[model samples]
Target chain A: MNDQPAASGTPASGGVRIAVDAMGGDHGPAEIVPGALDHAGAHPEDQVLLIGLEAAIRAAAGTLPPNATIVPASQVIEMHEHPALALREKRDASILVASDLVRRGEADALITAGHTGAAMAAAILRIGRLPGVDRPALAVQMIRTGAPFVLLDIGANPDSTAENLAQYARMGAIFAERVLGIPEPRVALLSIGEEKGKGDLRIQRATELLDASGLRFVGNVEGKDVTGDLADVVVTDAVTGNVVLKFFEGLSTFIFDLFRDEFRRSLRGRLAYLLLRPGIARIRDVFDYEKAGGSPLLGVRGAVIITHGRAKRRMIAFGLGVAAETARTGVPALIEEALREDAARLDAAGAGAEGRAEETTLDPEDTP
Target chain B: MNDQPAASGTPASGGVRIAVDAMGGDHGPAEIVPGALDHAGAHPEDQVLLIGLEAAIRAAAGTLPPNATIVPASQVIEMHEHPALALREKRDASILVASDLVRRGEADALITAGHTGAAMAAAILRIGRLPGVDRPALAVQMIRTGAPFVLLDIGANPDSTAENLAQYARMGAIFAERVLGIPEPRVALLSIGEEKGKGDLRIQRATELLDASGLRFVGNVEGKDVTGDLADVVVTDAVTGNVVLKFFEGLSTFIFDLFRDEFRRSLRGRLAYLLLRPGIARIRDVFDYEKAGGSPLLGVRGAVIITHGRAKRRMIAFGLGVAAETARTGVPALIEEALREDAARLDAAGAGAEGRAEETTLDPEDTP
Candidate 1:
């Protein structure tokens, strides 16, 4: 019944297939299997391949929907294990199998709510990176001032250079344009102050590189401006972005909890809360990370979503939607093309002051 | 009939005198003069020296309170002027004059809401750094989970090393103990993740140093745990700290604005707002930077408060109060002593691995 033409390697009449790491996250198969089944049921045009230990997937999935199938893997990567080591030791891990599916072109995308480090490792080691891409960045879609913006390098490579940030700018712009649908995304460098001279040497160098690059560079933006829709894309080193993102999540939760406690304090508060429930829910949804599904591991050869470990069924279903959307847009291919163009521009500029830009070019052999 | 003893160069019976930068901040003398007057009016035992251009200060002063006096400064440093240059060129600038007052012991402390870089520059060049302080760190007091905590290096030195972080831990602990009355404050290094090896090399090295520093090092704290009473002192490089602090302010303001807009949407929402006003106000007050006054520029020879540039009367008054409290508690002296002890401990530990610790020792000639 699927009508959408196969974009990758599935049958011409088959829909986009998503490989899900069902043995991932805190709840393991119990949460992930049903989530995949639900998503498959909801979107009949898409298929889900649940990857995990065979017996556990069977037990947790119960009765799968028509579009859902189980792909058995003998091992599961635990959250605490070292990412690279675990991926090497556990070759048959669910995350690895899911990545392999995407690598082999059997699946259009892979979704994992498991260990972030492991998922990234598997994607890099198996699915590989897009051409002209050195490191894959985690691009998170967040809302600030009633508008959505993308923040990148949110825990990919902590020791990032100016070149890495510049690459992030290119990849992030592509993601913003194709996925977020913002034409000519305004990219900002996250620094301590708005001044070009502010922040550390790395930031200063990145500022120079971004300014010279042909992107719509909107100078420096501080942390205060991050949530104000000042730019379509905010770029930073993984350390800073990860910290800021977590802080945002934590503070939002804390504020909501404070409101909840205050509402329960008195009769007037209770009545007020009842009246304000809809408004509060609206605010909650605006701040909800789950609503955005999860961040994409940008610059990878195939679409991969690294969801939150605490994600529930609904969040996973939404993640499936995100993966499908990414697959449909073919963001990885677009990113590769953009990076190639960016590299060519840098090379044509004679590589005098833009030596850093030259270093970020993806390997030719890796090009699709 | 003030009974408080003079702490500095004031008369034996004179109370703490705080030199106020009357021409500083966005409102200039207009906001600062009234703020100083208010503080002097409320605290009969305290005196305020409002330093600025003579005519402007007098015009804004209106009818000065009993304990408030105006000190004429020929030059007023504009907010945008480079800090070090302004301090050198504008010899009689209000910020410089105020710092001079503290340096001469005519005032126990100095309060400025002007350009932060200029304030730090003026304080460092005029009042000088305490013995054993390589760089002065900014320490901000904030409330999270109903408990007061201190965050340091909140824009003092954007470029920092592991040694600077270790020094901050010492100074921060001292400030927390003496000012915030937290005994043996738990100090945590801010990083992207809680894992020991999660962040960049600087963070990893800082983590190792903190572990061996003999302080109550609480390992690593991610951004999410920074505001939840997870650590009594959260230490980070200036860039990260500044970004996180500003992000907190921005997010809090955004959430409040969201609430305000939601409340105005419908009649029931308006009613709920009327009932919820008290709770909202309480939340606002809790997150108010003004209520906590300005952050103290720690490790300086004299107590200097770097208040917000947009600070109004109430915030300025609170800043004066903070200055008085810092003077009363002898925080600078205590910090110096604690740092000295920490240095000696490191020296006794053979200084084999931590050679950087020796470079931060206070100059013997500069010691109090």
Candidate 2:
């Protein structure tokens, strides 16, 4: 899939390319085609390869930007599809093909509007993890906080050990400082309460390990704090984070729907909607995920940003911005270096486990 | 103490008196004073007593009811003070005095707006639990799913076992069906997901145990379902439910604050607020805890309704209404029956563990 198969490791002379899965997302080729065009149009110096069936891509792109072009692929991993099985069986799926472009040096990065699990899986399977990293995490830049709060393994590792949580805190902290530009970002373990014995056995044990981690740890925070910007980086197992994330998304929709119904009731109601429009907009913007783009599969060697399955033009544009910022800042390399240092310390300390990465049979690419 | 002691038997007599903690809550004397006065004024034939400092209770009662009079006590339980310790040490505290009224022959019930922990501790020590009840649960009447959903153990038994949750489910179902007038109240186990394995360990275990319970079980329901009138009784560990309760309170405030702020911004906004005002008011009124009053700490031998620490006139008034309704509905006798049946079943099952009431260490009258 690289520009030259013989030049997989060769450095590019100039320009950067991002591969986007054009056939994925609710809007499919229509939204992805224009989003890529819109992004590449804004940045003439960069190129974005639209990977999908060429005909579908062309039919969707009403008017194309010169820097955006299509590369053909026939399959797509649907949002509800089993991610791990799809990633393995459908190697030529748009998401897999797109990730391979970055893996094989044809592109600088990969972005997708497919299933987050599938995209993360494809990236790990294709690009592979950085040396010494136990498990990669999914980190997001919370625009509300204006500082990244890395929610590692958001759906990646639902069941984790204390060592895994500690490693997540270490990687997440690095992501914030390197990519998000926060110095010594505060780390917090998400739990039911602030008390030491508040949560279940998992969090209780995890807290002790995280406290001893080299970074500053803020202890436990509740669900509201996930979006409240109280901590710079919030760490938790994937299961809890997934529930919180989805609950927030559903809650935002519920509130918005209630308002819309009330707003359309009468002229006066519409007037109130207009009057209170700004404040409501502020609330809306605070919870907006599009502006935040997708979760980046951290601990990988290259940048891979995964947007929602309903990604529109604006979300895609935000993805390009995130990818550019991440690549420019060298977040993955920094994370890799940090992980190596942590592993060395763990070995010296004679901790509970060593050579941990080899035991993790499930790769990021095997997500389901 | 009550005018006549309640017989330590299945059917408690209606002639038994109850003492009101007349100097509790944020709006103190005013709310408690008026609430007691209102109860005395409304129930002319019933036996009720008021306990607090004489001067304050008398002063609070600008207009005294014909049947009610103040029983002087100097102590008060501040909301910020440690509840368990305070309840034990401050013998004359209104909550302590009121609970002791039941222990003696002064009253059959005790109602308070003091710290919840302190009040619960006082009741457990003074009046004690019913024969078969192991864990006492506070059954909250939540307006979710357009019905009165009995949320049991809402802020009681913070750390619970599988059997404790099952018992709460049974009690909650009984409360809803028997008191709320819901026929065969559907009981749902609150969870993160509808799938069997999709919640914390406690919930997963509770789900299995609850199925074996004789109550009308309705599988699992997510956070959204809590508001959609799907279940009559929702059972969860108190800690998770408390967070959900707090979260809902915060969310409601955040929404209204935003709306009110916008409405006050300009003339146009004010006009809009006026137009949509009715709908918004209905929503707020539907959610107001004051209207719901105090949640009864079920599973005890007698009624001990725990009102909010922030109780104002409206909440205190609601508390009176709750007390009146509970007095008329015979929730206490039903609790006693349930406990007896539970004890027999436990003995038959050969689960020869200490009774739940014994496990929950209660403070002595002199030591918290």
Candidate 3:
């Protein structure tokens, strides 16, 4: 049995319960249900709630494990449907029901590989946000240099303000410290240049705020330095972060296509590729986003992992592993604790902390 | 012997005159002088004015070719010096002198593999801006997929507005059409998503403007689509463009490093790499920054190309080639003509063209 207490309510079997949106993503329950059941079989200490149309889940997963339960969700939000409108119309959508489970403390975490906008909306509208947290950030790990680093606000807040960025840096630092096992993560602001004064007005002001903040501020970092071993947490506005992340996603595919084309160009190339297949796969594995599982939506009240829309069985299982780990470690609670301390520190410094904190405080109903 | 006239002044031998900043960049005169001489030897129709300390240029080149001339500059702008401050203090700096030559019509084009900030400053302060042009942009070519495309505003104006980005699109399209040989170049705005409304406020506003601007507007393209030939010209703010460009630079190096380490891991890997070296070189050649030569500083009144600061003899030579070609094509003159017509179209459409044109007009002395 598990000794860890849930954030609000008791678990069904004294174990971590992860509610999965089986009717989400491209393949939906066909891929998600089996992955959830497999994870449940592997980790008996964790219970998997496969939420979807009950018949679809049962058909996809012929025989579910003892630790897996089917939580029927009546509707599925199509990928192209407007997220806010769909959520409003489809009350029993899988993503909504999964998020509701986390809100009601029936599940410790929620994992979805479906529409990203819908997932974020559900997390904010149902799971709510940590106190004093203006917005939740999507933090993805970059392992290009063989050492994993965190890049946050990847797509959550396209119009992020300096304060939002500062908050993201703090949240990102907590993620790195707790999940990545880094003690006091060195966070850096992503700018055009490595110099502190080289960025735009927002980044310049953010630098000053970060310097005054209690976190280990590593100053400014450029795009070139992000892949290097310079800092553990790299923060940027969601616009830049999202573009950078997509570029990375595009690059892997581009480079691999280039390799394949080159290898097929000649007999020698084909022979060489045959010999170097292992090496190529090794390099591919290092930069594989699927192997990194999912990006965590930090600053929310519960653990939420957003996997790729193209995620399959293996990726879903890996995402479940991340969800379980984050839930067990109580990353959301840790972030809330850190933000409270940060607020207290600002109060001690007499920096108008009370008013600013109030301005960022969000009510669950405020989000769509 | 030559027929193409200089922008304002008669060439020494009725041929293109490119002023090369010999004392700028990491290698300075040692790499620059030889590159200029080699280019001068190859392009008998072009004149190369090597601008630097006379003694240093002579020492680096040993002897200059007939088409190459040494233009003595007493001062050199160090890489780390503040660009505006350095341009004011060191009036005879190599980069400044190069820009001055272009301004006075003594040189048809200016090419510098120096401090990028200094290169832009010199272009703006000494060379001046084209008529009705608000700001100049740096446009670089990306050839990752073996098809080259232009990405603009790489590092020119970090605080770019909607108008600035629109101008960049026009300039980038011109470059792609005339230089890169793309007919009616498709221009796209770089954003977080491909939808017209997917970007920030500036981008969304820019989308509306671009749709009305009468170019081959391709709505919005995300970072993932940049390298894939979705558009010939991709326009963005300097901040995002610079980050994407630098990320590409970093990715090539990182991927190659991974390949090297992976290859060295085992005997089979080593043998495989030895055989695949030729194929690898081909892939490397396609993505090489040095091969791309330089980024054209569009919107300046004179032809200006900013090469990499790490330029060696070969890269410097390639930069000179680009400068000569851009000058010969009269890109700056074409841009001014196009803008005049654009203003006319806006005037006919009753969009307050006169006021906007007047607002954007830059006096030569207004720079630096």
Candidate 4:
């Protein structure tokens, strides 16, 4: 259902084509369509392919801009469904169609505020991974501390090995350097303590690999240090990374709730809140995941952006913008080259694991 | 050296005898002595045995109160030293002396803001563990969101087995019920997701064990939900818990910094900050770890409260208060009884590991 005048853009040369899953997020096409339209309007040279049901897209979008096209997909995958099974059953699902567009070079990048598991599945199964990359990690840029930093494998590759973590450090570093414009990005392995011998078995091993890898390895940084300016890119297995990410997100919300309670407690607090409302708004803007423009599914062959399922129109628009910028910068290609250059060293490190295992002992102790 | 006035208090009534490690924290006796004295002053019936270098303790405390006594110790363990090595070398360390006092029933509880590793080592090597407890877990109560919730094994056992987590849940639940006063506390496995099979192998296995352990098992709670009112006791391996605990601590500091920056950004912001300063102060009070007292080292034979290395006067008093309360409730004995009763079921679950291994698949995917 590619019923579109696809080549309508009168660009002289370079332009990005982004595929957005219109029926993916909680608000579906109602939120996504307007966001896609806004992106298309802003970047007239770039094409925004809104992939979903044709009627819903048109209804939500009203009149689409010249650069935006409605590429129809008949099915929608619900949030709670098992990703793999749903992808297999719903062959024409919106996320699948969006990923296929990127895979086939019809779109330069794919953006979705969909079921995260489904998005990751589609990115891996349809768009594929870079050579020598064992897994495609999701990297999120955190602006919580004013100085933006990237944390990787947020919810991908739960059972990551030391090699995977080392690889994540490399990829995250490149993203920080090339996309975020941080020079010689200080890379750190997220662990329980700052000491080299701290953390779990895998973390201890990863620390050694990172130290030897020749990146700006900052040894180990704890969760407390992540929100500081200590490291530009932090790498960890998906479980710890996911938990930390969610905790930050949830705690910010909880903090705001606390403020609300405090403000409503008395008349003085209420007046104070009135005076402090703008400052609170700025704080909210800083912590808002939407302002970060979603996370990039790193190590994939194509640019795949995954925003929150609760994303609104503005968030969707920002996510699409990130997708366009990532595709324009050719981050995936750079990552492939970086990995290829470091392959021999990583191989030697893996082979030397047994020798290194004898060097460090796993002693359980309190870190405080 | 025990000195002379060990049993000076005349009244033959119920009163807790607490051994305080005066040379434990960053401030040493300078901070700890005042706090212990304050506790002794507040609770005149209870006795506080100040254990440290006699000269330093005397200098820190010019005059001891009637209920407080100086128990001399000749050594102090630096924070950076290895616990096992330090304990072997400094046999008469303040922490060691405190632990020995508790072991010999001279003191009903032990409190230290010293090297956490040393405190844990002293507690285990001197005071010993409760019967059937494989590892002693450190449980910290968080009051960031107004509701207090306990997260366990913060930095005790990094490589925890499924059985260890199950044991932590049992211990944490008992602490919540008896000490925190939460009735029939809801216990949850700290994981990446809320689903049954959402975490790493051990956490997934622990989920099953907790389900059948006869407690109010609430399945799994993610890091995001830990700050909320979802669960009273959240159990995990030390690595995750340590990172989360530090993250919460560090982020709270970073957030206040953010507020400071916002306040300094403009004239209006500075005025607004003045008006809202009291509310912000209340927020600080909520997130203050010192206000929660020290973390309890559960599963040990005696009441051992481990405070921060940076503990000051008020924090030390709060920690002693916690230690007194914990000893008064006989938490360790209660934990022993609970474990003895549930030993059969836990043993059965351990044996069923092989059969359950085939039931769940470890899939690497995003969990948004």
The C-alpha lDDT values of all candidates are 0.80, 0.68, 0.81, 0.82
Name model 3 segments beyond 4 Å from true.
A1-14, A351-368, B1-14, B352-368
Model 1, residue pairs in steric clash? A132-A362, B131-B362, B132-B362
Candidate 1 local lDDT, residue B81? 86
User: Model 1: runs farther than 4 Å from truth?
Assistant: A1-14, A62-66, A354-368, B1-14, B62-66, B354-368
Candidate 3 per-residue lDDT, tens place, A126-233, comes to 777777788788999877655588998888776788888999999889888877788989999998888775677677768877888888998988878778888999
Q: Estimate, for each residue in B130-170, the C-alpha lDDT of model 1 and write its tens digit.
A: 77877789989876867678998888876788888988988
Cα lDDT for residue B312, candidate 2: 76
* Deviation from native of the Cα of residue B357 in model 2, angstroms: 30
Top-DockQ candidate index? 4
Would candidate 1 be rated incorrect, acceptable, medium or high by CAPRI criteria? acceptable
lDDT of 4 by residue, B87-166 (tens): 88888889988887887778888899999888888887677777788888999997755568899989887778988999
DockQ of 3: 0.27
lDDT of 2: 0.68
DockQ of each: 0.27, 0.12, 0.27, 0.39
Instruction: Give chain B TM-scores in order.
Output: 0.89, 0.86, 0.91, 0.91
lDDT of 2 by residue, B175-267 (tens): 676657889889887765565544555566666666655668878777656666668888876645665555555455555666677778778
Best by lDDT: 4
Show the lowest summed lDDT stretch of 10 residues, model 1 chain A: A359-368
Model 4 Cα lDDT, one tens digit per residue, A1-368: 12222221111246789999999779999998898888888888899999999999999988778898999999999999988789888999999999888777788888998899888888877777777788789999986556689998888776688889989999899888877888999998887779875887787778777787889998889878878889999998787888888998788777777778878877867876777778888887777777677899898777789998999999989888888877777777788888887877657657545525422222334211
True contacts kept of each: 0.49, 0.15, 0.50, 0.46
Score chain A of each prediction against the true chain A by TM-score and list the results: 0.89, 0.85, 0.91, 0.91
